[model samples]
Target: MVAPTIQPSLPRVSPWALSSFWFGSAFHWLLLLLILMPADIERLVGSAHKGTYLGLLSGLGAVVALVLPPLVGSYSDRVGKRITFIRWGVAANVAGLLVMGFGLRAGFNVYLLGFLLVQFGNNFATAPYSALIPEYVAPAQRGRYSGVMGLLQLSGQLLGGVVGALVGTAVVPRELAFVLVAVVLGLSALVTILRVPEPPRQELPADTAPRLGWLQLFAQNAFFWVFVTRALFSLGQYSVQPFLQYYLHDVIGRFRLFGLNLGNAVTASSVMLLAIIVGGVASTLLAGQLSDRLGRKPVIFFAGSVMAAAAILLLFGPPFGGVLLLALVFGLGFGAFTSVDWALGSDAMPSRRSFGRDMGIWHVAFVAPQLAQTPQGRLLDWGNALQPNLGYTLVFGIAAAFFLLGVVLVQRVKNLK
Candidate 1:
């Protein structure tokens, strides 16, 4: 009983290898969610009904994102070919992005199908892809990896914001922007496919084979807590996200700088998002490293609390400048949370052999909030009808509550730092 053998570690990840794929992922998604989708829906259905239609689209598409990942991940676990799944997913996603772009004038049904396809493809790739993290990095180094992930993720958001402001104002490209989205997204995945090799499956030395049902395999207490915590966080974020453009227009009024028209909602929203991203970028890497030294729980708790406070402040209908400052505050908290988000689930994974499947179950948390989009949208409509911007107040109030609860519940997650 003298000394334990040290396992050889995976090579350190290059920053490019770690970040490029995620940056592309964030870029396309933000382009769609924040700018394109809203503008398109408004154009098709008009501003009066934009919120409801957007909610309908998001909620419907969310079904695919919610269901596909867990099942696909389990299949990937069995097949041991995560890269193949990723390739297929990318192909489908790119095709869907093209359909959405080119089919802009083709009515809502075509747009809906395109979005559904994108959702399916994105969730399909991400589930199996997420397992790569725990496989490639040592536990101690994960915070650094997450930090890098957050930084690149925010950077992509900044680019998406720029593109959206430029092209998304009219629901696109005209088609070049949409094509650009498909291109950039596909190219990013290609980078990872070419440069980052998938790690070989890690199997337990002394395996005990036992028959367990699908839910039983992944339904541990820690998993349950983590799922609830994550779902709550996503709930908070999405509550405001789908409505930000509208908020900038309705509540703050369209912005202008130096006696120049900033082109209504898109430009103002982009400016707000830029501020947010700046704050998030500044804090992301630092937070990730901090979590490594200080424990994930403390960092996440503090960040969530900050976000909750910011959301609460949004209820007042602050002026444009004040809103940008609040966005900055919110972004700082957002960066810290996202920095460690993957590692959060990775740490609490119940089955090493079934990492893909378990992680996919956790991925459901991200999509669960999408289910609320429609209901919340309807609520916004109703509240606004009752008394102007009352809907926003309710939506933000609930979001703040969700944020606080999500952060607090993490304290209950056993066996996680």
Candidate 2:
């Protein structure tokens, strides 16, 4: 039998509480190590089949991401708050890191297992963690929260890159890196658990509301479509991302500027990443703040426009000797998109009824993009063989179209009001 329904006013979230959200995101860069380990694995194995091995590992990780979230999110929803999963998930995450450390120390073929576990830990905690935003945050303050999170993400990426570079670039002492990452992740998890209090669960009309079929529940919510749009856009956006180093090294630096020389290629790639970080910081912060003042739609629209422009620049800019400027522009656009996109996603959820479950759906959008990489790689190889920069140009042009389509889709989502 259904119980009586009660709905309380949403709670006010403190800035300190919001800061913890960013703190958690900062720890996320550790997950990148999982993706990166394959290169080291290739060197260790002394095989020419690194691509196949990398694909298998990544594929397994993607499968884990797809499967784990719904189970974890549904469990969190049933419990009426996310803390249960959040606390334990962190413990499990640390344990996974320890396992990874031991695996590396033992010289076991454990990269695939460790990567899958990392994905599981990340998603298990991630969905439940994000659900807190819609429950506690005032819709009006989401912009500030989004901005801070963006800064945290960028800082985390920079820190991760610096750490990777500093680890001597040789074997990387895998066990040590794993241990340090575990410690850092644990510290961040502790901050979130102790500092941020969960919002009380809402009580909706239980008696009259019919049990919902998944499709029916989804059909009533326009937010799901927005999530779809977000996913498709992300897939299109990243179609060009993996090739950034390639573009800088082979096309811009080696072929065009340095006459296909290998020496200048590495330095150019490094400079491009630096440019990206700088531009990304500037645009993300600016977009987040602007969204706070002007409303999300306007900021989202502007971000889309910037992204489209950047995509076009990437396509043609290499030939004109403007690749660095294009790289910076692309970074700016991506920063703007990511900075506000999270809060925008939170705002569009159907309700706090199952914030974790909803957020799991949102995350699927973020993760699904990786599955497209294989096809994109094939396209790149084909295009590169035909003409220099041709593959990149086509890839980025498609990304631009996706951004433009996202702008149109954003207009259709009147759910925020």
Candidate 3:
């Protein structure tokens, strides 16, 4: 007998609690990318090979990111458990991070293993966790909730940068940063698990086929364009990001702007990142609420343009202070785009039955771009060999083109809102 419906189509979930895990996720990512990895790679390989080695590390680690999420999410979908998978991932992550700390002293291969494990652990947790919003939140509320997601996510990143800055200044031991990351991950995840109840297990209909892995998802045109646009934007970002510390060191060094002397390249990089995060935090929350009322495309349009303009401006040799302002502008636009990110994805998901599998597939847009890091590094290296600091100009130009292209293409997405 069919049961009569007794409640709303979706369950009530606290946006704050729902977004707690994002903070943990963004925290570790920034911690590693901004400080830990760069410092270690530079020490191990020297500055000349730093870009290439770092790219290799990212490319290798992303193999796990590319292959693991769909498999893990598909299994979680079958088993019908989210928190258990997430907890197990946390255990793995802590182990990996600790190993990385020890590996800092041990050797490069050992350090690589730690990074790979970190990827494994992070992807395993996130694949299952990614499905929660679509399953729990009402469509009308998604923008605001997504805003909350971006807000906490950036806030986490800000804290990570702060940790990096502290480490850069030698206020905190590098090893201690790993501990801080592990503790934060555990606490935030505990809050999410405690506050957010998992929905009851669902059974696949008799006729519905199980959603296969990544390739099958490409056949859905609506999602394919969404994936493409997102990948382009991310590619633009990774193009600049993976080499930002190097850019700071090589291009803009020892500038005194506004009575502030930032002679240290690492400290200068942290300041720029902080400026970006500050702008990002403000816009992330605002844009999410705006996307709810104004629609996703319009907000996305504004965001992409802003980012493109910033990238183009960066190609010009701006003063150190001017660059900081440009960074803030870039952050504002990027934050707005991210605010609407999940709402758009939720809107375009191909099948309700395969939220886990489909979201896992969708997430490849972010991961796939990391694969380009090797080529990007090679480009920088190649360009620099030909001339001095021409690599930064070439890279910045590439980033601008990516931003413009990504912005223009968003209009092509069906009016899913």
Candidate 4:
């Protein structure tokens, strides 16, 4: 056989080279703290009732998630500089964090104020920041970039969990966690300010692209269904997440030979999260590669199956005794699904003219679940009335259903070559 000379790999932007990663990493760590805060705040307030507070917090976030992206993206495109919006957005997010931190320190009616500021700032920054990914990355390299992004996100979440565990173990005070969150976010903002190169202003063709009203654009896209399906997937996935630790502590602990320990609960949740991070990074990379090679629908089908399987396992049992190996099963499937989901979502964006606006609409699906938490909580309460495990099982089942629905909808997406 004749030998074929191999070409050297092309040099592109290093996935970790940009300031955005630093900013994004810190943003993720602080976000995880926010995730852990409801329970912490409930304990701080000397009230056993954390459900209503959490429900309201998540619901308001969902509302903001739905509204912010299109507004930010459209404006950014019109203003002709994405970074200008991103810079201001990060500043706003920092301001929001300061308010939240001060509220925590001052013993004000901080829950509502904290939640609202955090949600607004977080979404304002996130919507524009995410839109940049497609703008900067070449279509061919997107999967690798997405994988790197997912890996960083997961690592940041794990880092946050470690901090939470230390706090729970008396290694750090709970109040200090909020300070840590603020500092991390401030650092993330600084990184964005320093690192990401702002792209030049967009020049639209005189006649090819008209400045359409938001509602007009929303009404025109067939991909809108895909966006809604994505939102459903988000709703199902997150609806069960906030309560996972509670489940491990309350339900799984019953099967323990040793008594339930809070530290053990955090450890188990940390383990599950670690599994998710690992699986998610691997699967995301694989999905992106496969989507590029085998096409998007096949990868979507494979990923949907993995997601549904994970949901079923979590529904049936979680952190099952070391013997059953439940965590591994859930982690593998969940991770693969996430990888494909990012790949598919990125694949579905339209032309550059509508990219910012459409992407903002798509992201609404990602954040829409915050609103659903209120209804989910009500459903959970109703389920508790019937049986202890019924609510969680139902939630997991719905998550699986949404995953499947997302698969079905992806089949309808066109121009995804």
Scored by TM-score, the top model is: 3
> Residues 1-417, candidate 4, lDDT per residue (tens digit)?
311111112224456644344335433533443345555555555433454455666787678878988888776665545556666665666566566655665553665576566667767766666666666667776666665665555556656756755654467565566667766666756665556655655344444334456676555444565676667667767777666666565557633424554445555665555555556555656665666666666765776676677777766554445412554554555555554455556666655555566677777877887677777766665675689878777777887887788778866666664
- Model 1, residue 326: distance off in Å is 0.5
Order of the predicted models by lDDT, top scorer first: 1, 3, 2, 4
Q: Where in model 1 is the C-alpha error above 4 Å?
A: 1-15, 168-172, 201-203, 207-214, 217-219, 257-261
Q: What global local distance difference test value does model 4 have?
A: 0.60
111 Cα displacement, candidate 2 (Å): 1.1
Q: Please provide, for model 3 over 120-187, each residue's C-alpha lDDT reduced to its tens digit, 9 standing for 90 to 100.
A: 99888888888888778878989999999999998998898777777745677888888888888888
Which residue pairs overlap in candidate 2's backbone? 254-260
TM-score of 4: 0.84
lDDT (10s digit) by residue, model 2, range 194-266: 7676655556664433434457646755676668668766776656654554555555554244444324433
Task: Identify the leading candidate in terms of lDDT.
Answer: 1
lDDT of 1: 0.83
* Reference-based lDDT, each prediction: 0.83, 0.64, 0.82, 0.60
Instruction: Give the per-residue lDDT digits (tens) of candidate 1, residues 43-128.
Output: 89998888899999999988998899989988887776677888899899998998998897999999999999999888888898
After aligning candidate 3 to the native by TM-score, how far in Å is the CA of 341 from where it should be? 0.7
For candidate 2, the per-residue lDDT at 191 reads 74
Off by over 4 Å in 3: 1-10, 203-216
